[model samples]
Target: MTTSTAACAFERKDWLDDYAALKTALEQRYANLAWFASPQGGVDLPALDKRTRRLLETAEDESMAKAALSAFVSGFHDGHFSTAGAVLQPKIAQPLALPKVDYSRLNATQACAALGYGPARGAAFSLPFESLPGTVLEADGLTRAFRSGVVAAPDGTRFGVVRIARFRQQDASPAACEQAWSERQAKGAMSEADVKPVKQAANAAWLRTLAAQLQHFREQKVAAVVVDVGNNPGGNDTGDWAVRLFTAHDVHSARMMMSAAPLAALYFDEQLDGLRQAQKEQDPTPEAQAMLEQSIAAFEARKAGIAARGCDLSWAWSEQRPWQPNGCSRLIDAGYASGQSSYLPPKAFGNLKIASSIYWAAEVDDLRGAWNGPVYVLTDGGTGSSAEMFSALMQDAAGARIVGRTSAGDGCGFMADAPPVVLPHSRLRYRVPNCVRLRADGNDEVAGVKPDLPVLPTEGENDRERAWRLLDTVAADLRARGAKP
Candidate 1:
């Protein structure tokens, strides 16, 4: 959104108390309170408090207090609710000028010149679309499934192009289902000795189909393979699996996050106390009390382990000290324990398998040597997380050219830290942002990855138009390079 303070509207007395209350809440959430109690631990609460106050007083839209407050809260950058519930989202401004282009040829040099800027003076000119090195014909029809103007090659035995517009849970392929079932059955029925042949056969069959497809494109003397990994919002790991047909590589990076101890403590202590007090009256039987005592012991043990880990959590969290809530001070075990709470938070693999598998495929096979064809990838704005990861890895491993706008910026990778919370008054459920999307360089900003050859289609191009532009450009480029289908 526009971070320009000049554009906002503000009034002096419109929301004085609300602003003050919001400021207090924010301070409590982020200020380092734990160090205040320690002899050597000094916190800069006063400075932080003063800074926050100043921001509020000077905020541009004091009349629209909620917006200013929310923006201020987001400034903390902790991925939590720093502002009040009244805040509204900000709007971002689009760029003033579009990139230069020609409908005829897809050459980067020509495209760059069309944009009015001089050629990237010092920038290296790698043929990003060259990732599709073996195809003779362009596969442009795959955009039907992705209505967001994705450009993909027509699925064929000779020259195949696949472009996923976004990651969607509803897009699981039947082939994926079959593969999962086969893996499960093989694991259950076959001994270690018998499993190898079965697994090999399955893998071989998959690779064979891919090999045949690549071979067809090779015969056509294709010159490139383009992958459009634009705004893919991420679907099943199968998306990565599909990418394997064109490239060889595996995703090796992994990321996971845990809640802060203080936060966890607050949740458990309050929740446990409530449970213990309720159990005392609801089920006064000796068995119930005994169970409660046992649960408390488990919680204590877990807390001790947590302390030992010495995580670099926030300072405010550290001061709470075995901070068990009222009734929960004695029995705070999680759901895995024999108490009321027994479930763990959900875990996501971030398409680890899919990533690694594709990397492996691309690394082992030399697309330039194997397929005499062009590859084109089509994507839009929904691609994120694992989808982004897939794109980054493919570009690194096979030089697969990207042919779409930047993807959604949520790919750094994240997982749900807590269950969805429905507000008592509004009945609206809110989820926490706990994942990060980063490139190999560790930059976790969003927008999306830029395309090598930027193509902004006319509105009339439609989804079909977008797809045709990518394929048509690639084919014309190939013919210029002396390749013929």
Candidate 2:
């Protein structure tokens, strides 16, 4: 691929004198990044050194380089910071085309299908579909099948659903978006009181509405429950609420274990894997040999520590797994248990807010047994983080069949704070990822759970239509079993 010439030319200029204050402010902003020390409670000197050199060399005018490097280092899939400083990338200037319909506001799959989609088929007890590579679906042309529930079914077995496509707005400035979000929050798009501390009562209210719909299916003796999370960009408590609606009241919380030790496990694994791949090449460097030794030493130390704690070490034996170096990545260390849980506790002790704020109890007694029939969940690339966590828990605990497209496997749970870090010479600004997100199963190291049934929508199947198809399939299954529509 051809490299960027605009970036190279800009790097040649003496931008220091021309943009001194902006450079200074940028440097100051990223300084706090140093705080992200390695497992031994010290920053990896080599890594930091390399990163600093990269920043300085590209700081002059290579905006693309900066963005690429940031993304490379952070490991976050779509972190906005990585896109910063791009000088020559084409700006988005095309005339915008708003979605013809607001699928998000539609509560049922029948309504979504009316908008122009196919029959509903869920992850379980349903047929598969296809994908559309270069198509933009218009929302205004479809039928409307909505009534009172967030999700609906056209038949006893088929499941129909509705969800958000993606959040896209023309001319959406950061300030403007924040303002709009604030206004929406004020208007109760989520809850009445503060959205933070994730209100259980308010969350329950929303969930009860969904559960009531499910109850309708139950009353009709429907075979399955069609759930559409497509439009779900994911709210804090929304996924949690879903779990409560489907599972049993006697649910047990899965143990969650998190520490900096897994970092060594991941690092050594990557190094070993890279060497194994490079072993097929011509000559391996002497530096690579030394790196191998260091990685082995670190791996041994981490293994000993983790093993003493009775954690599983089988992951250490896996060979040559490709590694993604973005900072958001994780590797699961073995450990799993089954039981009942209404709330998740802190992995360690520091996260009091998370441990206490989340309430898992709800009106539905048990999701696994509540329906007394088949259960289905719809997912796609957008299902991530807590949503992924909720899905995994359901699959593991309640045996819910996951349908639609594969979920976004970006399930790291730790929150990233943007505190400022100061650099040594430039007095520059930077931020580093702190804290680890532990899964319900206790290991803080795994990517999001993959779907059991991976079904992609057809090329012409819009998201709304996909949900409806799933619902119809589920409804048909229910009717076949002598259930009412």
Best by TM-score: 2
**On a 0 to 1 TM-score scale, where does candidate 2 land against the true structure?**
0.45
User: Residue-wise lDDT of candidate 1 within 375-476, one digit each (tens)?
Assistant: 545545555656765665454434466666665544432222344433232222333333333344433323345565556667665655455556666555
TM-score between model 1 and native: 0.42
Which tens-of-lDDT digit does each residue in 13-62 have in candidate 2? Answer: 23333233332333223211212222221234345435544554567554
Q: Provide TM-scores for the models.
A: 0.42, 0.45
Task: Quickly count the clashes in candidate 1.
Answer: 84
* Candidate 1 off by > 4 Å: 1-159, 165-170, 174-221, 228-231, 238-245, 249-374, 420-429, 445-447, 458-465, 472-485
Give the local distance difference test score of model 2.
0.39
Positional deviation of 309 in candidate 1, in angstroms? Answer: 10
